[model samples]
Target: MSRRPPARRRPARRPRRPRQQQEHLVGLLLAAAAALWLMATVVHWLLAHWWILLAAAVIAVLGGIGWWQQRVQRAQWEHAQARALRYGLPQLDALSHRQFEYTVRDLMYRDGCTDAVQVGGQGDLGADVKATDPHGRRWVIQCKHRRHGEQGAAVGTPELQVLNGTGRPVHKADVVVMVTNGRITQPGRDFARQQRLHLVDRQLLASWAAGSRPLWELLPALPPPRKPSRLS
Candidate 1:
C-alpha cells in the first residue's frame, strides 16, 4: 500500500490584534462622549443663568464709566491749578468784596484744597470759603476785604466772635480762619488766640500769597492729619 502523503499541517492560527484595536476605539468613544456631555452641561447652565452674566456686564460697564469720569475731573483740576493767577497786595486791594472772596477760594486751591469754593454771599452765615485741606481738616474761612491795605478798618472781635460761633456748629469746621488784607485789632487778636481761631492778617497774607508753603504749615496748633482708611 502506498504511504499516504502527510497532510500539510494547518498554518498556525494568527494572533488577533483586532481585539486590542476595538478596545482602544471603545475607550476613545467613551472619552468623546464624556467631553460632549460636559460641554452640553456648561451650555445649559449658562443659558439658565443669563441674567447673572448680563448683570456682570452692566456693572463692568458702569465701573469703567465712573473711572473715566474721575480721571477727567482730576485732569481738569490739575489744569486749573497750573493756570491759577498769583496775586499781590495791590491786586488784592483793587478787588471788590465778591472778588476778594473768590481770590481766597483760589488761594485755597493753590494750597491743595481741592474742594475750595466761595460761598460768601447772603445767607452764608460768615463762612466765605469752605474747603477741606489735604490734611483732612475742614476749613471755614471768612474774608475781610480792605480797599487800602493796613490803613483800612481793622478786623475786630465782633467778626471773630461770629466766625467762632458758627465755624464749628453751623459750618462744621475743624479750623476757622479770618483772612484780611488789613490789621486785626489787639482785642481781636487776643480773642482769636484764646478761641484757637487762626488769623491771616496783612503781613501773614503777604507771606502766604508769595510763597509755595501750604497754609497749614504757617499756622500752629492744628489738629493732626487724618490717617487714610484701609479700603481707600
Candidate 2:
C-alpha cells in the first residue's frame, strides 16, 4: 500500500470575545477624552449611537417589570387557590372579576407560556389575556367567570364570534381561547368547532386548577381526526 501524504495542518482560530465585553470595550474607546474618566459617558455614547443597545435596555426594563408583576400575581393566585381548595375547586366562583382574570393569567404562565399578560376590562375588545408560547404563537383568551349555579348561564356563539373577530389581525393571535366557569351552549360549541376556537369549560378549568391535568394534555390546537376513507 502507498504511504498516505501528511495531512495539512489547520490554522488556529482566535478566541472570540463575548458580545457584551466587545460592546463595552468599543463604547469605552469611543468616549471623548474629557469624559473618558466617567463610565456613565461611555454608556451614554453607546445608547446614543447604538439604537439596538437602547432598545435592549428598554426591553430589559420591561421584562423586569413583567417578571415582578408575574411574581406578585402568582402569589395572589396561590393565595386564592388555597382558599378555593378549602371548599373545593367550586369555591373559584367566589373570586372577583379582576381576581378571576389574574387567576387565568397565572394558569397560562404555568402552562408553559413564555409570557401571559392581562388586558381585560373596558375596551379589551373581548380578549382578557394575551399569551405567547415558546414557539412564538400568540393566543388571546377570554375568561367568563360565570357562577356555577342552577340559573345555568351558558356562554354562547355571540361571545365566540366577538373573540374570533378581534383575536386575529387586531391582537395578532394565532389562536383564541374562551374559558368559562359555566356550560357552553350547543350553538357555541358548533360555532367554535367551525371556527377552530378553543373552548375550555367548567370541568376542564377545575381539573387544570386542581393540578390534575397539565395544559399540554388539554391543548386545543390539535387537529380534528380525519374521517375514514370510504374506499377502505
Candidate 3:
C-alpha cells in the first residue's frame, strides 16, 4: 500500500538567479556606500566649524604624507641594516657603514666636496656613491672595505671598467674615486695613474683608521705627506 500510495512529490526548485541581478546588486551597494559616505561627510561638516573641517583635511593630508615617508625611511634603514649585518656589521653596522662612508666623503669634504649621496643607486647603471664638490665637480665614489683582508680597499680595473663604461652614459660625471682600505694592485694603480685617476692610498687611509688624522683634521689645505704611526 505504501509503495503504491503515491510518488512523493518533490519540492519545486527555486529559479536560478540571473547574472544581471548580481551586477545590479553591486551597483546598488556602491551607490548606497557613496550616499552614506556623503551623508557622513556632510554631517561632519555641519557639526564642525568651517575652520575645523579645513584643519581636519590638512591634518589628514599631512598624516598621510608623514606615514609614507616613515615607511620609506624604515624600509631603507632595514635594507641597509640587513646588508650591514650580512657583512658582519651587527645592529651597530649602520654606524660602521656610516663611519666608513663618512671617511670616503671626508676626502670630498676636505677638498670641498658637496651634495654627496651616501649610497647611490641599486638598479641598472648604479654607482656606489655620487657626489658634487663645491666647485660643481661631480665625483663617483666607490667604497670597498672588508672585515677580512680579502675585501680590502683598492679598486681594480674591473670596477673602474664598470664606472668608465657607466660614466660615459651619465652627462654629469667628472671624476671617479675608487676608494678602498687595501692597496690597489700595481696594474690597477698603473691604470689609474695612466688614466689620470686620483689615488687615495692606504698609508693615508691608515691615518684615518688610527684616528690620528680624523677626516675633520684634513682640509683642502693639508700639508704634504708626513710620517705617521703604522697600521697593523
Candidate 4:
C-alpha cells in the first residue's frame, strides 16, 4: 500500500538458557544419586534381615487360612439354622404386633430380599416393612396383626386408604402390599383390587410362609422387574 512503510524489522527473540542450565543437570544428578543410595540401603537391609520377611509371609499365609476356615464354618452353621427354622399361621398369630412386622421382614430376607427391614413404629406412614427384591422391585408392606387370627376385627378400608395414599408417593414402592395373619373385609379387598394393591391374606400368607416360592411369584399383577440402576 503506499510503498508499505520501509519493511519493519521484527524484534529478536530472547535467547534460551544453555542446554545444561535448562535441563537442571546438577539437580537431576543429585536426585539420581539420592535414589540410587536409597535403593542400595533398602536392598542391603532386606538382605541382612531376610528372615523377618520370611516370617511375615508365613504369618500372613496362616492368618488367611484361619480366616477362610472360620468363614466356611460360620456359613455351614447358618445353613443348618435355616433348615431348622419353621413358620406357620399359628406361629405368626402368636407373635405380638411388633413381632409380626419383624417376621414379615425376616420372610422377605429368606426370600432373597437381603435389604428387607422392619420400619414399623410411630410415624411409619402406613409402611411397616420395606425391601428391594432380587429383581430390583421395591416393596412396601403393611402388617396388620390380629391376636385372634381370622376371628379378630377384620382389616378395613381405612387402613387400605392410608397405604394407597402413601405407599407410592412417600415410600416410592413398586409393589404395595398389606399382609395380615387375619381377614380383610370384603370392601377392603374390593378397594385393594381396584387400586392395583396386593394383599397377603391369611391363606396366602400361609402358602408364602410355608412354600419356597418368593412372595412376588405368589402375588399377581406385579410390576415388571426393573433394572438395578433404576432402583432408588
Candidate 5:
C-alpha cells in the first residue's frame, strides 16, 4: 500500500494593517516629496537659471514615483473593492423575480441567444429561461433575485434538475445558467460547481450592466416573450 502525503496547508490570511500605518506611509512620502521640493527651491534661489531645470527634473521624478506607487497598489485596491462588494451586496440592485428572468434573457441575447423564455409555472423543476442560438443550440437559465433582509436562502440544485428536464430528460438540456443579484450561500455555489451549473452572481451582472463584459448585442429593456398570448 502506498502512503499518502499530508495535505498542504493553505496560507493564513494576513490581518488587516492599521489605518495609522497607511497614514504614516503617506506622511513619509509627503515628507520626501517636500524635501525634494525644498531642495529644488534652494537650487532655484542659488542657481537661478538652473533652478527651473532642477525643479522640472524633480517634478518629473515625483510624477514617475507617484505613477509607480499607484501601479504597485492597483491589485490591493482591486481586492479591497471585492471585499467592499461582499460587505455591501444588498446595496446592489435586485430586480423583481419576473424582471430578473427577463434581464437574464436579455443578457443572453446580448451573448447571441436570439430565442429565450421563462419556463411556465413549474415551481422548481423547469428551466426559467430557455434560449436558442443561430446554430440551433439550446440553453436554459434560472434567475434568482435575492432581496435584502428577505430570506435564509435562494436558488438551489433543483434548478439543475429543472434544467435537466424535471427528472425525465436526464441531462438533455445543452446549457444551464443561473443568475442572482446577491451572493449565494456557500452550499448553493458548491451545488452549482458539483453539478456543472453556471452561477452569475451580483458582481457578474453589475459588470455586464456596466459594459465591462463584451457581448454581441444588448437590449437595455427585457422584451416581452415573442409567443402570442390570449390576454394580450
Candidate 6:
C-alpha cells in the first residue's frame, strides 16, 4: 500500500509561437525593405532635380540668416527698452542730497568702479563718493544737485578749486570727478581742464543713464601721449 502512493503530476509547459516569431521577422524585413526603397526613390528624385535641391538649400540658408537677424534686432530692441526704463535722469533732481550722492555711487559701481561708496556728510572732506576704477585708479567724486529754479549761480570755478584741494591732498585720489545734475560754469570747465579733473554734467549723466554712452567714453581727453583711463 505505501509503494502505491499516487505519483505527482508536473505542470504543462506553454508552447512557443514559432509562426508568430517568423511572422515578426518577416514584418521587420518588409519594413526595412520599404524604408530602403523609399530612400532610393528620394535619392533618385533629388539627383534628377539637383537644381531644385540647390534652390532649396539656398532658400534654407537665407531663411536662417533672416531668422538670426530678426533675433538680433529683437534683442537690441529689448535692451533699449530695458535701458530706457532702468534710470530716469530727470528724476534725480527730486531726490535729497544724500539720495543723489547714493545714486552717484550706484552709477560709479555700474561703470566698473569697485568699492563705490557714498561718504557724503557734513565733514566728508569734499568727497561725496569714493571708488577705484578697473585700472586701480582711485577716484574721489563730488555730487552737486540743483533744482530747476534755484537762485544760486551754477557750480563755478571756486567749486573746482575746493574739490582739487581735497581730491589729491586730503583723499589721495588719482582721479577727481565732479558730477552735477545742473550746469558747470565755463570757468569751472576751464579750471577742471587745467587740473585734469573729470566733470560729468547734466547731459552727459543723462546719456550715461540712457545707455547711449559709457562714463569712460565721456571723460575729457588728456594731454598728448597720455592714454585714456579705462574702466576696470
Which candidate has the top score in TM-score?
Answer: 4
lDDT of 5: 0.59
For candidate 5, write residues 72-132 as lDDT tens digits: 7995675454333222344335456776676666555555454656663556465667776
lDDT of 3 by residue, 72-138 (tens): 9997775454333221222112334446666565444433344655664365353666766544456
Q: Positional deviation of 107 in candidate 1, in angstroms?
A: 1.0
Best-first order by lDDT: 4, 1, 6, 2, 5, 3
Candidate 2 minimal-lDDT segment of 10 residues: 223-232
Question: What is the TM-score of each predicted model, taking all chains together?
Answer: 0.66, 0.57, 0.43, 0.73, 0.44, 0.57
Per-residue lDDT tens digits for candidate 6, residues 32-98, read 9999999999999999999999999999999999999999999777555544443566587777888
Model 2 CA lDDT for position 45: 83
User: How many residue pairs in model 3 have overlapping backbones?
Assistant: 4
Give me the runs in candidate 6 sitting further than 4 Å from their true place: 1-85, 149-152, 222-232
Worst 10 residues of 6 by lDDT: 223-232
lDDT of each: 0.89, 0.76, 0.57, 0.91, 0.59, 0.80
Task: List all candidate RMSDs to the true structure.
Answer: 21.3, 22.2, 12.0, 10.7, 25.8, 11.9
TM-score, prediction 6: 0.57
Worst 10 residues of 5 by lDDT: 214-223
Give lDDT: candidate 5, residue 22: 92
Which segments of model 5 are wrong by more than 4 Å? 1-94, 120-124, 134-136, 149-171, 212-232
Comparing candidate 3 with candidate 6, which one achieves the higher lDDT?
A: 6
Q: Identify the superior model by lDDT, candidate 2 or candidate 5.
A: 2
Scored against the true structure, residue 2 in model 5 reaches a CA lDDT of 95
Best model per lDDT: 4
